[model samples]
Target: MTTTERTAASYFLPSDEPLGLVFPDGAAADAPALPMPADDVLLRLYRGMVSGRRFDTQATALTKQGRLAVYPSARGQEACEIGAILALRPQDWLFPTYRDSMAVVARGVDPVEVLTLLRGDWHCGYDPYGANVAPQCTPLATNTLHAVGFAHAARAKGEDTVSLALLGDGATSEGDTHEALNFAAVWKAPVVFLVQNNGYAISVPLSKQTAAPSLAYKGVGYGMPSMLVDGNDAAVVHAAVEQAVARAAAGEGPTLIEAVTYRIESHTNADDATRYRERAEVEEWLERDPIARLKRYLTDHGLLTEQVQQEIDARAEDEASALRERMNVDTVLDPAELFEHVYAEPTAALRDQASELAAELEERA
Candidate 1:
């Protein structure tokens, strides 16, 4: 048999459904199983969700106003975005996709910095080392390899660090995703892969993307533990990710997490979601909205009184306004900056290009 044939045959067996933690009806089958976080922690998680929603809405508006080039909003999947990051410690690193600005913000990155790439300013808006969060990745599944390498290097240096990589469901179809998982498992790299399985990957739906039972099961083939969580449930998403982060820290290697969520908005301001997905389907998902579900849970627990709710709303509004104000200002561009960060020592070819740009700018000035 050919090497390719042998490799293909290894995944012939049927894999079990991933271990799920929460149900859509606001009940958790595993909350009792894992350590419950304090009420304050839960409240903070809720605030993050609210903040994510506000950020998405504000960014989307910016795109319409011509301030932002494009935006892939995670309006419905805020729980997964915020929940995963909230689970990470200060020293841990985060690899986020373009749609995951919420996760980037949760990591303490400035909202304007998070949108830097979309604003067409630089490769990544924020300094990765400063916040321990990678620049939001525009390419699919590419950050997976980076996350694995970071975790492996940290482990090699005996530093207690783990990386959580956030990617969309469509990223699973990329070869880099498979390679990263295989390398992570074999090398015992402390990284977590959070697949925000938000129904569709741009115009393509999940059903057409893969025949596997679930994206989480993809980890089983790589010899890693897999988890499934109600992505709309902030608490469960946090719990599952916290557990995965804890496991990775203890040297249990990588984990694959599938957060079942939906993208409430179109893929971006440019795409027409109405072309492929039914409005009915979107409305159905809205019924299980992450923000609403968490708000209900908090309200029922008396953690979200009317006064507290009012304060949260006010904070979200202020943040949205601040983001709008910061983004509305025109950014001063130095055309030569494009060639600056590409290399440690600029090559002759790049040097020539930079000089040309400098001359052009001087001419314009």
Candidate 2:
């Protein structure tokens, strides 16, 4: 047979199937058994997945209501965000982008504190020292470098900390990402660059981002290992990230993981996806929704029942309601707090400016 015929036959051959969990149309005829997790941990994962979706929905609503400055929804990418985070240890650092609030939530960051940043009260809402989570980096791709630097520092200190940096497909085109990979490969930094290929970076499709066949293979140039996985499959994402983390922790250099998933929503509250993409395309992805796939997996395995599902839904609603209530609380910031951390000792120029600002305010009052 010719090469093309052989490749086609391989896809049709049952014995030559791809090795990974497959859930089509959010359903599996014979559900595969999952590794037993502690009852609390299992429930927590379910709760987190549900709550994260609910939080994203509510935050989007708040943006429409003008209560929030702007919002980014991780509606369909919850599995990618949560699964990778659930695999991390407390000591490990997470470098999150603007859309990684779900992962940050899974990392033990308070939803209200995260909202403080969205509400524009603080540049960084959560205390990194307390939560072991860094502030969400707004500038794209720079966090990859930060993660590499952090991993290098941890390695120097002989600590077993791993750094996971999350970015979108659009960020792969940035120079900082290339620099991060080069630095990590040379220094053998324990960092994992997790790219969620949600197909678009603010309306620009992945096709426009790069001509490469796969983002994962980009690691080849830096001499790091890489893999592409079904990002919507929580099981696959969890397993892949677990393996990558192990490799990094074992002193192997960084790994680039390109998770193939769909965004299913606008890039942010300000975006109108319909303007650029057709609704039919969005609906097509809705059929492969990540949450539905996981729910079906659990249900088919008899791990989730109607009552359990109801409970999970109720819990998510309660948490989201509480978060909204907390966000409604006074979000005013102390203007002086900004200057407090700008320098160890205020420079003469800055001090003079602060004095002038204080006097101007007093005079206006």
The candidate maximizing lDDT is: 1
lDDT accuracy of residue 57 in candidate 1: 91
lDDT of 2 by residue, 116-168 (tens): 77888777888986767888988999999999999999999999999999999
RMSD of each: 4.5, 5.7
lDDT of each: 0.85, 0.80
lDDT, model 1: 0.85
The residue ranges of model 2 lying beyond 4 angstroms of the native Cα positions read 1-20, 26-44
Count of residue pairs whose backbone atoms collide, per candidate: 0, 0
Model 1 poorest ten-residue lDDT run: 11-20
Q: Tell me which residue pairs clash in candidate 1.
A: none
Residue 340 miss distance in model 1 (angstroms): 1.2
Evaluated against the true structure, the overall lDDT of model 2 is 0.80
